[model samples]
Target: MIKREWAGETAVIIAGGPSLTVEDAVYCQGRARAVVVNDGYRIAPFADLLYAGDAAWWDGHQGAPSFAGQKWTQSKVAALRWSLRHIQSQHAYGISDSPERIHSGQNSGFQALNLTYLLGARRILLLGFDMQPTGGSRHWFGNHPPELHRDSNYAAWRGWFDIAAKQLVCRGVEVVNCSRETALTVFPRSTIQACL
Candidate 1:
């Protein structure tokens, strides 16, 4: 089970949307606790946590992510030699209130949201959660390696996020979308500087 280590603090989750920039990640350093999703660690290696769901990703990284902080995954069988915390996965939609597991929402970004909530973050900020292709690119670092799924089911993902937003509100948690450009309209928008 995860501990409420960051109780009442703000957490930032960084995704790999094309609208994301290294500057965005750099700006968040020391400002708030951060969770970098998938390859987002390349830009924000100093982030507090790294989360990925695909086992293939773990395989590609040789089961050893370069991230310095905690590395978390929903993948049941990660190809890791060292210990990696495996959080239980629930249904695909909505947020899981339980601290022991998180609803996948079929994307790392959404899962990171559930994680931050469980970690006791009262406010969560989303960066690079565009949820749609921007500037003709799916992600800031470009497409994943050939073996992994590339296309995103944006509609379904958005629906899941919408449900999660409402649930967070009911729990008195605050969520803000701080992406520079985004298709997600479920959360109130704000600039990273303003949020900090």
Candidate 2:
């Protein structure tokens, strides 16, 4: 089992969404533990952990050497590299309480939330989890390269989070969505400032 090293602490998950900003990343630095998902590390390099589900992302970024924190993924090929922590993947909905693996919600952001919980955070604050596109752009970084997948089935992703929310409540974990704008309403909403 993963040790509850951060028990009772608060964690902030930074995701790659249009609503994310450098200011938001700056505010999280030193304020609380952070987990950056996919390209979020570009803005929050100081994040404690980074999670990406796709192996191609790691390959394209050359293993994200700029990020000094621990890297995690469910991709076995990517995890084979010394820099990453490999958590097995389970095809299911809701959070996986077991430390050995995680439920693949088919999105890196949702998986990052489960990782934060496994790290022993009692309270989790989400930023940039906008499940919908903004200004015709799907992510803050614009779109992925032509070879990579660019489309997101946000409706399906949101459903997974809804299921995860109920599971988290049962575990006594508090989750608050602090995105400036978002379509994910499974958790209670709060402003980043209020959360900080």
Candidate 3:
């Protein structure tokens, strides 16, 4: 449904990492098209799009907080096991021949990035893509409990983003990492203020 929604326009993707601050949320609200990641809705209530890859996450939220933007869940075989009720792109299966599916990143942020590209965002700015915890919170929402995700799978996650970044850049899209604290170095780092 995101056919050229922001063609040649800028889009800000808000991830749930701790680096995602209230200031960043404010900047995206009425400025640019906001594409929020799972649980990021708590911050950017008016997000233009919401993306969740893991089915368990949908179940855990129990769909408590409804979103106004189109909610997308990965259509991969494993992701459908949880449920597709009330979500878009459920029946879509297999992988696309597009570059977004090249490495088929597993994390929600990377997946959201690919979707944004498909949606026609020429310049995409990232916020809260810390890729690691800051202080005590793994996420701005405090949802990623340590007990559940012990390992954090840093290497695998980074690798996926690395591949995805290269593919997107080669395709002529500018992916800027606005979260300066992020461990991910694949994308050129920039400040949220600068991108805004």
Candidate 4:
């Protein structure tokens, strides 16, 4: 586990929101980089890092991106957990080849957000983490099929995001629900200009 230091106050966090300001973009670079979440990995060029259950980290045969990179560590009370050992076999094909960086042991959304919080960041922005699919707004799973699962598509995206947002706020790590389209109303929600 890459346990981040609590006292150092490092990095920021961005969801896959489309409206990230240039200032936030700059914050993701240089020394103390940022850690983006989920599809945040694909659209985003930088995030000090990312986290997910072992299954989400990749596809079994090809090692391309998959829903595993965006899943909760453990299935919710309503959902069921599936085997992701296939990802392990494709280890050589991912961004971080190390075994430790991929497996999600048993973290739900709370656990995943906590990984970023442990960094002791001064600021963490939950960008357009709007979990809703908004009719046709697609997700990664829709573009890439899960090799061993069923119905892991765009709609489930909302449930995972809601859990993660709630987890972040419950832990007192400021989370903003900036997506005008997704009215989850989980947190108070806010908007702030990135410091210029």
TM-score of each: 0.96, 0.97, 0.81, 0.50
Question: After TM-score superposition, what is the CA distance of residue 5 in candidate 4 from its true location, in Å?
Answer: 2.7
Models ranked on lDDT: 2, 1, 3, 4
Query: Model 1, poorest ten-residue lDDT window?
Result: 75-84
User: How accurate locally is residue 124 in candidate 3, as Cα lDDT from 0 to 100?
Assistant: 92
lDDT of 3 at 76: 52
Best by TM-score: 2
Ranking by TM-score: 2, 1, 3, 4
Which prediction has more favorable lDDT, 2 or 3?
Answer: 2
> Tens-digit lDDT track for model 1 on 72-110?
898878825436788998876689988889998988898
Candidate 3, 47: how far from true, in Å? Answer: 0.6
User: Which residue runs of candidate 3 sit more than 4 Å off their true CA positions?
Assistant: 75-103, 145-150
Worst 10 residues of 2 by lDDT: 142-151
Best by lDDT: 2
For all candidates in order, the CA lDDT equals 0.89, 0.90, 0.72, 0.42
lDDT of 4 by residue, 1-196 (tens): 3444544454445544344444544444654445555445554455545543434433332232343332233222211333322222111211222323432312222234445554455345454444545445434224334543334243444444555555555555565543434444655555534321
Residue-wise C-alpha lDDT for candidate 2, range 1-196, written one tens digit per residue: 4667789999999998899888987899999999999999999999999999888988988889889998999998998863688888898989999988889998999889988899999999999999999767788998988767767999999999999999999999999999888999989999777898
Instruction: Supply the TM-score for candidate 4.
Output: 0.50
